[model samples]
Target: MDTVRETTSAIKLLEQENIPYTLHSYPTENGPVAAVDVAAYFGYAPERLFKTLVTSDHKGGYYVFCLPAEKRMDLKKAASVVGVKNLQMLKPEIFEELTGYTHGGCSPFGLRTKLPIYVDHSANNWDAIYVSGGKVGYLVEVQPKVLENLVDAQYAEFTK
Candidate 1:
């Protein structure tokens, strides 16, 4: 483990709010990193690691969902929950502009856009889940409740 700590919007928020968390780090990679790979790097079960996904209605509306790394999103059903006919994964080209974080580094806490956040119900199955630390190669181990409260998020059965 590295003794040096890196700062990111998510980490800042955790510090400011006095939330308890364990920060984990890995070698920085040049391209997009997959959620499952991250979990493997930390030796955590895939179910206890989450990936933050941003979707758009192809209009101006956008939404966020956090789900287990090993699961797949049920796009059609997720759209139905938000009353949107459909939802498309957000483009990597503008991920940073929209969320203030890179593709694999998006954390629900520090998104630039004020979008609705939905956490998969499965997250409650773990005492703590690992999510991006607002940067690639970094992750934060935190209680699921901290995430919901931080983002005013809801729980949904949106994964298959």
Candidate 2:
């Protein structure tokens, strides 16, 4: 099945930038599938699969954090790095409005409006990592530095 979002603008951005990525698809379900599930199903290392999380301040401003599947984001630490007093996961509606993509389909690659991106320091340690392909049950493999180089993502200590 084609789990990738057919109408996502992220795909076009990738094509325009000539960024190489491997598209992966698995069975889509209603519930959340952890990044480990993707790694196991695709025969890749769990450490190499990343999950994109949307977090925000009290205002409308938001940030995208790309981290490893097994590691939990340290919200407090992240907030400190971003120089905000508080931060929390963005609501689904807010996410849709900001990125023009559904919760499971959100990709840092293409957004309706460009927002600041923060990559967990750990991600840079790896040569390649797997991220969302703008849809549920789909993943894209790319070099870790691409987030910073291509997306202008900042490096931060987002993990506890």
Candidate 3:
């Protein structure tokens, strides 16, 4: 028997807005799958897949960042883009509680709270990009502009 996939909040939001997206799923035996591994499993170039990261400012304000799976976020640049003195990655322990999504499954869309989102400027190079589908084992392909509009994201040079 085939397992039925339940719609994630991210998917629901996209559907409600009439945005086009494609869902891709992969099997997992171990714990949370890394974004790079997911991109490999789907036979996609690293630049075609992006990952969502949550960070907090010194004052405890939260922000979300989306960047290519192959790149590391430049904390200093990210802080500047977010208009904070400094920013740090949120603790893994509070990831799910704060974002309502698991560590490897966070999406900029449909977060537990409305937070400022930043997407790496490089994403503009692609007509479409894949991001987590608000769950492990799945990804959603969408146009960058639609995603940015839906999440009120700003594009910036935040990746190193």
* lDDT, candidates in the order shown: 0.87, 0.80, 0.87
Query: Cα deviation of 142 in candidate 1 (Å)?
Result: 0.7
Candidate that beats the other on TM-score, 1 or 2, i.e. the better one? 1
Q: What is the TM-score of each candidate against the true structure?
A: 0.93, 0.89, 0.93
TM-score of the candidate numbered 1? 0.93
Candidate 3: tens digits of C-alpha lDDT, residues 68-124: 999999999999998989999999888889999988889887888888889999999
Which portions of model 1 miss their true places by more than 4 Å? 30-32
Tell me the tens digit of each residue's lDDT in model 1 across 53-83: 9998966688999999999999998999888
lDDT of 2 at 55: 94
Off by over 4 Å in 2: 1-7, 30-32
